[model samples]
Target: MYTYIARQAIFDRNKHVHAYELLFRDGESNCYPAHITPDEATSRLLTNSHLSQGLEDITQGKPAFINFFQDTLLHRFPTFLAPEKIVVELLEDLDVNEQLLDACKQIKQNGYRLALDDYDFDLKWQVILPYVDIIKINVSMFSQQEITERTPALKNMPIKLVAEKVETYEQFQFCLELGYDYFQGYFFTYPEVIRNKSLPSSKLNLLELINVSSAKELDFNYLNSIFERDVTLTYRLLRFINDPLLNKSNQITSLKHALTFMGELEIKKFIALLALANLSDNKPGELLKLCLIRAKFCELVSAAKREYNNPPMGFLAGLLSMLDSLLDQPMSVLVNKLPISDELKMALSGEPGNLFNYLQLVRALERAQWQLVTDYAKLLQLDELLVFQLHHQALLWGNHIHLASQSK
Candidate 1:
């Protein structure tokens, strides 16, 4: 709930970043704000969330679940783990100096690998020559003349030279010719793009069952038919049903049991939201962050607006609004697959609804687009001064999440 930060370690040829080691094995990812000891990085400069959590987590105390990234690597990894723990970048335009030597020595002593990031070699920057274990060169920044000039000099170096920002397959092949190791960019995502494929009949059956579950009368046979179609989707469906964040008061024994109370449309939207969240895994980090923002706004706005009347559909509408962006396809493509209400559909497509206005307001707030945010706030009948207050509150929540992820 509080905030923290995670640092992106810069690297060179001689050094590299290894995996983040936190105190607890993060359930899904270890590339987080690896727990650390502030005293360990006593000399390093910090800003944003990292400095806040690193200092506080060290001075105040640590729970069993939390550990500093630095501390985690030093304690658990040791030996070859240093390489995975630190980013070894091939730094560009940096000259060799005491500062360079001191940092390299310090990093190496900490059992972390170093890499030169965005490497561009210069006659004067030879100071990084001996210390770099890995070199990262940005191929995108070079002209043909520059490539021809710099390529030959770096040919036979013992250090592993990694070429980054290889956007296309052709560019990747060219970089391979120039001897780049270990790519780190969106090229892999582009290659893995999901093409047009019709939804499986089993999925269709499950969706139909969920539609039936939402009727005034509960249909047990249709609900059972859902699992008979896709049992795996049912497991995720159950998890969504029971997640504390979703405000479930009790554990769900089964998907059918969840349906007894939450109803068909609610179950369908929750399932769809989970699918969208999973789909966002391969996209840009910005895309994932945007999804999180939309998810939060949906939950909060729905809870606020639905006070006079129950409308979980508002939550569904807000989350589904970003479905296109998440799937890298048009919203209309798969929107028809679900049996959402006409009001929810109108809300999603920006026609007009309680959920749509709130979503539009959130988009404006995110851009810091003052005029639109103001106009929306006025229409929502929220006080003008109070609008900024809520905006700032949302920003703080975002900042808190930003810091906590860094905390690991």
Candidate 2:
């Protein structure tokens, strides 16, 4: 059986990733199987994925919030996992009783951090509050008045409050102002488009660099000139190429050599990375990381299938998909300015096609929309396991590139 797992990032107040909530699916249904008990689902997750592959590889060393049914908790399944590596989240549907309370206390005593998932303000749950380190509130489910009235009390306590299912930047700001310690949502993926805003010269320059780099035939002279014009971009590109993790045997010394060495495809990606990093100056780092993951994932999928006549175009499409979010402009406007192929422009502009389906697959995996993932995979004729593996590889590659770009 294939163990399909997707992670949703949990962000701190500053929007830095704090942890990830691991969502598991046994099949294309993208949710728990009807016949499998929650306990069995959790068991299979721990045994097949967490144990076989290890949580560190899955979570990048950050703690994972794994859900536990009352029976799973009572069976001490959490103790088998590393305490430092996971936060045991108790499902809200579980009945609060002596046995549950005792299990909570025991898990707490064993050095496990406990979180209350989808917490509603109920007096019955108060008895177990002492053991809870985090409380997740589905912000979508509560009225503003209800949230204001309920959150203040939780704020006064030692526990951290997490606003779940936040869908827009406005809601994120509201939750931040309301003293939410952590946020869980896809809000960051959206563009906070401000009308009448003009792109500054510096940003326009970056866009030009991206456009030039993305051409069917690379303009080596123009690319080298662009790099030479900005010392920081040149330094970043060189440092990235020379990153010990890249396992380069010889040092890359000059702009010309670097441009020629990386060839057309890699040079385009490097320029895109540098330009996007600069473009995302004030944005969340996770947004940039997501773009990289999408770019690589789309490229890998297209390459594996050998469907797209221009395979590298998938990479370009994925990278530019989030340009709207990074620039705070509509994708339609951005695509108009970019001198890309019609298919790429269409894909980025939300037109449906094979490329669009590739992007949808990445988004579905990110959000743990399993059924949609299956549907997209089928449309693209991709194996579910291959999709999962590609996504994992993309995550690792994206994380590495993001970290490398940040390094001095």
Candidate 3:
């Protein structure tokens, strides 16, 4: 009895992550079970996932857009979740009658944001439109001209428009121009390659630091020199070592002492974090946050198995997974310069292996591809519930790291 859940990020007009739509599945079937009513699916999700482990753990403090059928709304299931933390999404197929309309009014009065999912602008929905806060439109269902014509009416209303199933940069730009308040899709994961864009020397040095730190053996003198040369790196390293979450008994005053305390594993992770924060300066912060989540999630999964020859490589592989998007270079080229192990290189290069399976499992969970998530989890010999729990832990850890980086 594993509780299956996955979230898809929603980005604002500026491409920053705004919220996540939490998708719930009853089983490895990857969708709502045909036998169970939508009402039952929402109930189980609330009881098993939301009630047991607060929503903040899974959503990293972002508001979750969760679907609700007419019955669930009338039953006040939305009341179980925190109003500020969730947006009650009314399914498009819901009957728009007096009872449902009264329920919608009460829900709005209760302080919960309301979203109309897969809205098609029918006159029947107009009766309840005044109570809605957001309207989600499936961009794939309409032509650009149709969208342009249909959207102007929404623009004048207080409601926000969310462009759903947006799959490419061009689509995002068009929607942006059309005044879409938010977007939902995989467009941000694709790299926007700028031809002949050279890596800055400072970033190259950071890459060198990442390469050196990930080595099989620590080069203490070499690492010390690199830290000594860059004051910002030294400051961040010390600050990371002293983060209250790490729980240091005594404050470390020197770089050598900090390295010694962290040993090889923590030092490697720190360097990776430093490089990630520095490299992703110009990109959306969500990319860095995703990398941290993947890194921590992969590390936790491999460490749980206890059968892999080297589990630390799992973290490195996950951390480097987004180098192509961050550096605007192909993964093959980036892996060549990193000096990581062949196994890690193979995994990051999309070749099949234990680490590759781990990366795939994280990705599948991220994209709500439950069958692929089940397949990769089976290949890795991990329990489904454990994977979900580990993903929750990773989200919390990533949120902490993301906040720490921002504060500095």
Candidate 4:
């Protein structure tokens, strides 16, 4: 029940982000299956994002572009999204007709903007041009000649043109030269790497704090000294523990007091998540969300089995599994730097152990491989239905924590 959504950034001519296009993902496959109707697919996605996953947490306050089928558009199914923060994108397959035109006009009158996705300048599409605020041209679908032939007519129109599927710097340059107002694709993620790049001092400090906090037995005096040295870290720690969801009866006055009350596991999870969020300032927030889901899933599985005496060990292993991707370093190197147990390290490295088994189970669950999930559940002596229930609960738990952290 983790509602997964994939978002790709849309950038303006100068490479500044203008918006994000949200794609529906069911966690089982990357593509939206043809069997599911657009209405059903979008309805599920809207519910997941608005209710359970948290839209602001996903988009981070940027305007989101979402696809709308002809039926959804005519029926005004997107009333939930604010006019200022959402752009209704008309999919390529939509038929241009009197009914669709009337619906588009109504949407415009209601103060919502419209964009024609994967647009081609054919005469059949001319009727909707007046209602469109933007036009997305799929670069991968058209040849240079076709694009050249279409540009003159497109230039005459008032709508802005965006180049989609721009996968190379050369393609980007060509699109820019052709007067595309915006661009989207994989070009931005492959920037040249600087040699011997290392984590920033701030990230290094946060990592150290997490490592210290994750210790099974935290020394209150030592932790307080570390917190005292960094006012920001101390404030964040205190603010987090004081959250109403934690349900503390009294206000926490000092670091040592909160540490004693909340215990090391809770503190460690909070610190690690916070540190990852801070370090991932430039990357997609979904990566951090995935990490949290994995950690919570592992922790829940261990607790359900009543094994691994230290539940935090499983959580720690799950969280650290993504460090290699986040830090752009090898997993072994990053694992060696943390002050965690050898068993946890072995588990993180895919060695056979108690924690590793849970990690593999979580991975299988994520991919929706029910056969493997059933196998693992049977091996662990867990009911398959209960495992599914726990995974869903973990998604909700992780999403709640993620939203709270964002509000801070």
Candidate 5:
């Protein structure tokens, strides 16, 4: 469940830090796993860094250079990341096919900066040059003479040259003379390591309870049985149900009556919100608030979509989307433990599915990607004003809940 991310500094010509490329670690080793797709790994890393640990704390307000696979680019996963705060780094191994080219064009049009990572220029790559803002050439991969000869006279192009793996002062000088605009490698320093401290069993159990509550087989009996075992949860449930919104006339005396009156849908939201609040203890409060907003946003969107009748799953999907980051666990591991549907799991895994698209739209709204948000809203046939209002209401609701909790 432990997570870690390292950041290598990217510097401008004046030797000041311009940006950072986030590096993922599989446990103690600071390397991406060979087993999973790079997209999943990067997604998990970004979830942890941006959602769990605030981006400002990690990047110090500098733009982050994040790696993305062709799948991620095609699916527009990077849309969740703020365009002004990220430089999407395209791996060197991706094929220059039509789909990839189209995705590159779309990313550029969306106002995001792009970079070619570990570049060894092939003639086929020329097609991507116009769309990319930066090109990173690995200095160690080639000899000095080869680098000198292969370095393109791209002075006319509106792009910057980055010299990667520059290991010494002499190599830095050589790259600078070769018109490299940015430099990265041990020639500067090693990446700054950030570790996720281990959580106690009590906190993990809270996470487990939250995951268990997200199951599709949720019912009054199942929820009652679970709540009965935990007095604190029972108390919180009764208190939440008796709030003026649910019980405006009479005070609820018993848990069974509370469950009966609140209905399964309302009970599920209560449990998700309470469980999220509990599990997010010691983490940033804004994370829990954001999750709640996303949960409501997805639920509203799903209800708006007449094609799908299931809104509870949509709610759970949004609530649990950032659970991995909140708990510092891989989403695959966490979602597998939940008794949720395969469709929900697929959505959580960043697979392209119904709930996945909903989650993506919710993410776009979260980052205030207005054009993308408007496009999705139109596609879903949702009123743009309503979408904005729902988002605003969700934010206010989150704030109200937080304030109420603070008062208590």
Candidate 6:
């Protein structure tokens, strides 16, 4: 059996982590006697170090609790905490039985924090209410209309309110304005309107040339003409073509072969991204390192999960996802002119958003952005170490590609 492990950080609508490293299990297996998948181990992921560190960063308080829940078995319970570090989260679908209630009450008496996930107003489940320290509300799950109408009832409870799924900056602002204490989602990365900035003429020309490249029935000479016009682009193009990374696949020689091998449209897109990357020439080495990490991370998760039909697209999604971060442009604006698929475009929008959810999940994992990583990684069927190794490979490939281009 293969499984993926993810660290879940449980939050209230107010965006406080009542529980960090919440484990969840993933991957498929019925083989082993143990019968545990990696995903299952981490499904309610608990890592003492990562959780404590996360708590300290968020609450600036002393560690107060330490315990581990192996499914229903509560083991490794520590004597005491300062009423901060540890928080217990009731999974959204946890059955509300007397036994569970007793467990909740006992944990509360032991001086631990608690939270409820995706909580919608239900007076029946209110039995668990008094025990929970925080409550997470999905902004999308409950309409603005619902909150406006229901706040009066919700205010009667002692639990703190946390808002999840704050997708747009406007939504985030609205939630904050509406008194939501916590925020989660991709709003931080996506701007309301991606500002368009004029590129250097040389850079713009590269983008323009690549955009014009034909995907089918291409003439190598004509395609090469575009690169010849820009010495740097030519250098980078040839470098990527013949680099060790490319060497493992096929030894690319001549402009026509490059065009044919990469496909005209893909070549165009790659060149555009390459030029976008060069926008940060002075800082390429550092950014390249990070971009490679993200790319490789996404590729591994996607590849292992078997989600994408065209595996290379997943790989490219990881690789090119950082174009905006590199160019200081909103990816939407930059990608508008590229020839890549819509799914690849969606990856940049953030994971679980559209067709690129897997790729986006990979991005989240690399940054350790726990908000969407756990759930999505569960879907990807990839483990952390595999993701890490893949990210390392991406860095190596990117470095070779970068070096080869620079040499030109």
Alpha carbon lDDT of each predicted model: 0.49, 0.86, 0.85, 0.74, 0.71, 0.55
lDDT at 307, model 2:
56
Q: Please state every model's RMSD to the true fold in angstroms.
A: 10.6, 1.6, 2.1, 6.0, 16.2, 11.1
Clashing pairs in 5: none
Candidate with better TM-score, 2 vs 5: 2
What is the C-alpha lDDT profile of model 6 across 249-345, one tens digit per residue? 7777666777777765556545544664565463424345445545555555655767554325555565566666555577767777666566666
TM-scores of the candidates in the order shown: 0.51, 0.96, 0.93, 0.66, 0.49, 0.48
Q: Model 1, 112-208: lDDT tens per residue?
A: 5566667756565466566656666777888756876687777677776666665654665666666565554334323333457555554455446
Q: Candidate 3, residues 1-408: lDDT per residue as tens digits?
A: 346777889999878889999888776466776878879877876787654467777777889999998789999889977898999999989988999999999999999999999998789998898999999999999999999998998999998999999987788989999999999987777777734668888888889888876788878788877777789888877777788887459697876787777667787788778878888887878889899999999999988997453328888878889988888888888899988889999999999999899899999989888888888888888888788889978878988888777656
For model 1, the superposed segments whose C-alpha errors exceed 4 Å read 1-96, 121-125, 143-223, 239-251, 260-269, 273-294, 301-329, 336-408
Q: Report how far residue 125 has shifted in candidate 4, in Å.
A: 3.3
The segments of candidate 6 whose C-alpha lies over 4 angstroms from its true place after superposition are 1-3, 7-23, 27-86, 155-157, 195-332, 335-385, 388-408
lDDT of 6 at 356: 74
Candidate 2 worst ten-residue window by lDDT: 49-58
lDDT of 2: 0.86
Backbone clashes in model 3, listed as residue pairs:
none
Candidate 4 weakest ten by summed lDDT: 187-196
Q: Can you write out model 5's per-residue Cα lDDT over 1-408, one digit (the tens) per residue?
A: 223444566878776668877655443223466778877776666666433346655555789898888788888878887898889999988978999999999988999999999887688899898899999989899999998887757645788989998866578889889888999875532111123546676665565556556655456565566666678766775676666755688787786676567665566677777777777665545556567767777877777775453337888888888877676667777777677788889999999877887887777655434556667766777776677656655655655564344322
Tens-digit per-residue lDDT, 29-94, candidate 2: 567777788788878767877444567776778999988887888888899888999999988899
TM-score of 3: 0.93
Return the lDDT, model 4, position 239: 75
- What number of backbone clashes does candidate 4 have, counting pairs of residues 3 or more apart or in separate chains? 0
lDDT (Cα, 0-100) at 264 in candidate 2: 65
Query: Which runs in model 5 stand beyond 4 Å of their true positions?
Result: 1-199, 217-225, 307-311, 404-408
